[model samples]
Target: MEQRNGRRLILLPLPLQGHMNPMLELANILYFKGFSITIIHTSFNSLNPSTHPHFTYHLISDNLSESEAVEKDLLLLISHLNRKCYEPFRECFASLVSDASKEPVACLISDPVFDFTQSVAESLKIPRIMLRTGSASFTAVISAFPLLQGKGYIPKLDSRLGEPVTEFSPLRVKDLPVINSSDPERFFKLVHNLTYQTKASYGFIFNTFEDLEQHALATLRKEFHIPIFPIGPFHKCVPATTSTSRFLSQDWSCISWLNTQAQKSVIYVSFGSIATLDEAQFLEIAWGLANSKQPFLWVVRPGSISGSDWLEPLPSGFHETLNGRGHIVKWAPQKEVLAHQSVGVFWTHSGWNSTLESICEGVPMICTPFFGDQMLNARYASDVWEVGLHLENGLERGEIERAIRSLMMEKKGDQMRDRLSKIKEKANICLRQGGSSYQSLNDLVDHILSLESLALIKHD
Candidate 1:
């Protein structure tokens, strides 16, 4: 084995914004802890290495165009990348290992989507940890796919949407992750392989603290034989030293706009980096925000509406109706916006990262989940943690308006805020010294160092 100065880790993020952000936060945390990071990423939604000059970046060109990603079906896009990435990823990984001057690669950390890395890491004789950048509860629900399938619950019927998920406690069928496909069986099979690969990993890393998800963490440990580490709310553990925006240029103007509003008077709206809405739903949200008569900071991403470049053609006089009351941006610095005193309620798609960020900031949420883990996360936010309200029966303007008003103006919103304050305190505690998340992170480093030592001994 070659001698090296410091431990070097390789990270392969899933390349979507929601998936990539938390992984990068993990990279930041590892880098702060004296581990060198090498980020091997795909061409679509790639991170610029120059912006993050400290980390080494390797591009595994998937040859997927921006237009192709937007046009292709979500499942098809993932399937295509999985097939195309394996060879290039193998080559890049092999080259990294064979290089003599560089630090001997200690371990590989990858998003669960890149489960193929388990095999590559095995061949290269390195430890691999699959980072599940969502709550342990959400991952537990998805990991129960086989149970749902055996009970004939998946390939779910629209009629059965209200049925309670008996295998998992306190969740209804509507709370389950939606696999939008004509062939639901095939999609389930594809995801089942991810769990299979996770079981083969050296360990499992979750972006959640133990107290925040006690039962779910217990369930995951019981279900999967692998060691599980709940070492996060990573954003709080590692402060953002610079811009981490991979895709959208953030609009900082809203921070000034937020300051002008009354305390807890503004509702923050963002549906995550992906998840495009149809025209009707988009218009409904617009009218709803307008009718609520509350100040709002809305992040209308460029391609938020299908086939549209902007929300310019919103309902007639939509801007004029709430001219002084609303501030719109292509994207807002979400963490800062949530932490702002003026931001009362968050109207969100309930993506896990967004969910945790809102909780960490003690901000309550109005969940309008789109698909996949979002459904499960929305349920946890509204039901388990009691920090949010869900928007059921789809997006009608009346419902949207009422939800905004209820969360921002009514007593119900105050109750959720009180609950969130306690959760926020708990999250902070977990990341502090001698806390659960802190100890877990230390354990992770120890495990990596042990693996590296064992590998060196074998080589010697």
Candidate 2:
């Protein structure tokens, strides 16, 4: 259902499912709004073409194992994208623009990570906008150009004592979500990737509500010259237009089960894809969830419990005892579960999508960031927004139980909840017709379209 806007654009997303999904959604919206979109996928993400035949797909090989990408682990592939994907990517863009079969690229909308894409746009002299598929607070943190490398801000996280991040705003570092960087080498590279790429992007768009992070948004607007647009939930702006086909079905049974529980009586837990927990970590989490005695729903993806037959050994018949009280499943529809009345809190991996989704639902969180910017997300959640609490590094059961109980039952949880609901209200206002985010998106579309008009006028 693509309307003919008589203009062409390139949509480049990173190589992960989370990145691709939002990129696809935005592309779909752009197409429906009448723009021709050429989506570029990494050599590793070539499966996208088969999955989405509607968009024009170009597969460019990068540093990842080319002939067969499945042979390499994801982190290696991501690293390769950072180190070696640029040159091939440039050649591909150049060729596409010169193809003559299609319109010249009027605009380039790239992922936040592919900040290098701005270089491509510059070479072709087309306007570019970086599409950040995450929270406003996280993007603002990057935009702030925080002393991410220095102490008192960067390396001083361990000593934070859950205290406030000074001069940041109404929020503190302790309330924000915190993720653990698995290996030092990868963490630094990823941080460099997030910050440098953002600074390099022409303009950037975030999938978040502006009202929720006023202080952060103010800080970012002052710091960066690139146009910043907050058009989100992103789900709100992008209709389910042609629900891209995928085999996964969200189980609704959990929602029905949740309905039977008391108001905000349940603790909802999930660690997101790509996070792993050993048997000990798994048991600790289980024991904590069990001890809360509050009814709960936990989505335990396969391999979450770790080791074959792992969940079997937990607390000797723990499942049977807690069977009626707790419902654990391999996978459940996260969004719906969050919206359910029974859910009071989320125990999460501090992933951007998960955090934003929880906030959108007005549910608080207990964050344990696994790696990458998840730590940044956790820090903001606890320190900045006051919407969630966090666990220290140990990942022990007592810690898990205590945190969950306090966040769900303690007076502190009530205070956090009050602040969080206010944020959610602000979010609702931003989604209205004339809100900043809505206006920003309208301007973005017009901005891209006008570039082509300018080129035509110059030729005349």
TM-score for every candidate vs. truth? Answer: 0.95, 0.82
Please state the error at residue 230 of candidate 2 in Å.
Answer: 1.4
The list of candidate 2 runs beyond 4 A from truth reads 1-3, 43-54, 66-76, 143-194, 241-253, 259-263, 305-316, 407-418, 453-460
Q: Write the per-residue lDDT of candidate 2 for residues 1-460, one digit (tens) a residue.
A: 5468788889888867567767777787677668888988776554446556678988877765543354324455555675677888899988988888787687788886664776677777666677887666666664443464342555546567466666555334544433343354554455567767666655677777666656666667777766677777665556543444222445678888998999988999888766778877787788878877878888777655557442564666787878699987777777768888888998888888788888878899999887656877787788667788867567887788788889887898898888878877776777678887667767777877777766455436
Question: Can you write out model 1's per-residue Cα lDDT over 338-391, one digit (the tens) per residue?
Answer: 999999999999998999999999999999999888988888888888999999
Give the range where candidate 1 is weakest over 10 consecutive residues by summed lDDT.
1-10
The regions of model 1 sitting more than 4 angstroms off are 1-5, 65-67, 453-460
